[model samples]
Target: MEPMDKDRRVPDRYEPGEGCLTTAVRLPVRIVVLVLVVPVRLVWDALAALGRAAHRTVLRPLGGGLAWLWRTLVVLPVAWTWRTLVVAPLGWLWRTLVVAPLGWLWRTLAVAPAVWLWRYVLTPVGRGIAWLVRGLGVALVWLGKALFVWPWVALWRYVLAPVGRGIGAVVAWLVRYLVVVPARWLYAHVLTPLGRGIAWLVRGLGTVLATLVRWIVVVPLVALWRHVLVPSGRVLAVVVTVVVREVGAAFGHCWRVAGIISRAVGRFLGTVLRWLFVEPVRWVYRTVLTPLGHGIRDGIWRPVRQALRTARETVRQTRRELRRALFGAPREPQPAAAVPPRREPGAPGTRTLGSSTTALTKD
Candidate 1:
């Protein structure tokens, strides 16, 4: 080999072990640090990547399934339980409180219309009926007056006064038919007997009364002497006047017996009447009056209140109708008549006054 080529070649003494000291040191430190930490860092990064991917892969489907299952099982049951336990009862309570009152108010509102109809319509009809009745009464009175009194007045003026003179012209016929001779016969025959009968009845009654009084006075005194005084005197005068005293005692006993019998009969009749009628009346009073009085009062009061309401409505309707008739737009008032103009005295001799008003009419 040439000398230059041999110089380009590595020298035998410049060996690999104879490198730069800084390069040698730096290369060993870098290699050792890489050897110690590079593989462990690579393993840890790979494990973290795998863990993140596994977490995503597992949690995605698990979260979706769990959400669906919760909606189907847990959430639905809880919602149903709430509806059954809390919401449904609350809704029922609200309906009972709110809807029931609303229904009652609606019914009350409906009843108000019926009441109004009765007041405005039926009340007016009743008032009209009353007015018609009053008019009929007045008409009847006028008709009665016209038929009875007017006819009598007309007959008296047009027929009876003139016909009464004709009756006087038939004096002889009247006398023969129903005048002096009949009067005298009636007075003689009927009046005489009637008077005599009345006088005889009166005289007879007076005589009977006087005889009764005399007998009543005399009989008591005679009986007193015959019975009491004679019996006592005879009884005292003798030891025991048996016949006279027994007769007097028998008369007195008869009177006492009659009185006692009459009293007993009257008392017995009174007792029977009390048992038959009075006890039943008292029982009925207690049962009906005391216990059921309020019910009876309400029963009667309802109809009477309705009747009073109807009567008040009728009166109000009558007044309203009268007001309408007097002041309603359908009826117009009549115009006043024009007064005649005053003329001056002795002002003009032949001046003619025109009519005070022309003919006026409503369309």
Candidate 2:
């Protein structure tokens, strides 16, 4: 070999130039960013500007002019015409033609006649009628009292008192003979024996029930608890105790041995996994999967996500613009100033004609 080619420091494989690789990578990235990002940014800015211009120029002025025209042409004229032509004239005519004349006529024709009739004819006639009624009531009461007392006194003295005494004596004799003596005899002979026999039967039944309970239910339960259940429980407890003690001793002996074996096995398994599974997985993730994931995220997912965001923003802007073009931007309603209530003249606590008429009728 030649002297220059025999140098061990030099490699025989072709090595790529750093400048060429950098240029190749950077030019395409710059061109792609200019082509995609710049035009999208420009379009977004232009749409925003157009939306702002339309709102300020066309929609605002039209809304204001329409509001002004409505107030001037419809609202004001209607209010003024209703008040001047209808409400005020009708109220004045009602007061002048209907209310005043009716009030005067009522006072003159109805009130005067009523007062005069009450003072002259009605008062005298009522007094006379009252006197007549009082005389008639007094006569009736006197007649009723006389009629009631005479008959009652006569009947009591002659008929009722003697008859009632004889009847009462007979009733007493009947009750003493028929009811009292029979009740006493029956209670003493029949009811008392029946009650005694019932009490004896009840005592005997209770004693038998007690004996049956002791022999059948209570004795069996006591024998089972004393003889069978106690012995079985004791044997079960002894067996369980022996089993627990043997198990505990065996577990104690095996615990350290098991722990040692498990630790050795775990260490061996961990080393083998690290060499066979863990280390290979780590290398693959670091070298292949991580780079691939980064490439997919940065190159494909990032652009798709950015494009979706742009589309969403554009759709929102278009919808807003369309709504503005059709219905105009919504105006926030201003809070109305609170108006103090207007009190009408002579309205508060003032009675109408109908109420006055009701008062007269009541009186």
Candidate 3:
């Protein structure tokens, strides 16, 4: 037994690629999956087909019955009513009432009311405003004339006369003080130095600008010729030119597209404005002129006149109340003594003249 055990080699550690155990584990799993998954998929497919077939068979008759019922009950009456009533009445009413009244009213009402209102209310108000404005304008013009016309001219002459005299005096003084010595000294020393400095600065700047131009603009051209032109020869030049041209063309196309878009936006805005303001006004005038005219006459003019009449009545009532309050009520009577004489002053009294002889004063 010991020799048999020694003679038998111990089994090597299990390796997946080289082991039978792994094959045993994998084979059953694959077989199980194939067995289970295939049947499940087939059943699912069969059930789907059966469900679709049943749905088609059942739904067709149901749809047909529903359509037939709808045709019999709902559609027929609605179709008949629409054809008989709505379309015909709209056309007749539009022809008789809507279009005709609109045209007449707009023609009469639009211009007349605006013109009348302008004449009555707005014209007075505008004239008053214009008068007020003109008064203010005249005041401003008077003020401006006062401020600028004579005063400024006199002030300018006064100031300029003194300045001119002073300048002339200063020039005379300067000629007396500096003509011989100081003028010659300034020209010889100061002006010579200033002119030389200006010339030197200008020449320096010109030299620096020339150097910068040579370095920045000329060096790049030389390098391009040496590296790009010589190495790639004509192809590089052609490719660069083509690229630049394509870029320019693209820029031009973008500009054109932008211009077209801008024009389209402008036109769209113009069209929208026309539709919103102008076309609607035109349609309204065309449609409802007579009705609008009647409405204005009845609605606005009548009410305004009625209001003015009511105001006048109120004013008369107020005046009567004021008179009664200030004086006395008209129904109240006066005493006989308080009343004035009924006979003329030239007529004698009923009693005899100088009958009593007792008088308060003698003349």
Candidate 3 residue lDDT tens string, 77-187:
888888788878888999789999998898798978888898999989999999999999999999999988989789879998889999999999889787967888989
TM-score of 2: 0.37
Global lDDT of each candidate: 0.71, 0.76, 0.72
Stretch of 10 with least lDDT, candidate 1: 1-10
Q: What's the TM for model 3? A: 0.26
Candidate 2's displacement at residue 316, Å, is 54
Instruction: Let me know the TM-score candidate 1 reaches against the reference structure.
Output: 0.21
Give candidate 1 regions above 4 Å deviation. 1-242, 289-297, 301-306, 314-322, 325-363
- Which digits, one per residue and each the tens of the lDDT, describe model 2 over residues 1-363? 011222223323224663454444444544544455444544554566568788899989999999999999999999999999999999999999999999999999999999999999999999999999999999999999899988899999999999999999999999999999999999999999999999999999999999999999999999999999999999888666655644443443334333344445546766997999999999999999999999999999999999999999999999999999999989999999997564544454554553453433553
After superposing candidate 2 on the true structure, give the runs of residues whose Cα lies further than 4 Å from its correct spot: 1-84, 202-363
Candidate whose lDDT is highest: 2
Model 2 worst lDDT window (10 residues): 1-10
Clashing pairs in 1: none
lDDT of 3: 0.72
The per-residue C-alpha lDDT of model 3 at residue 175 equals 92
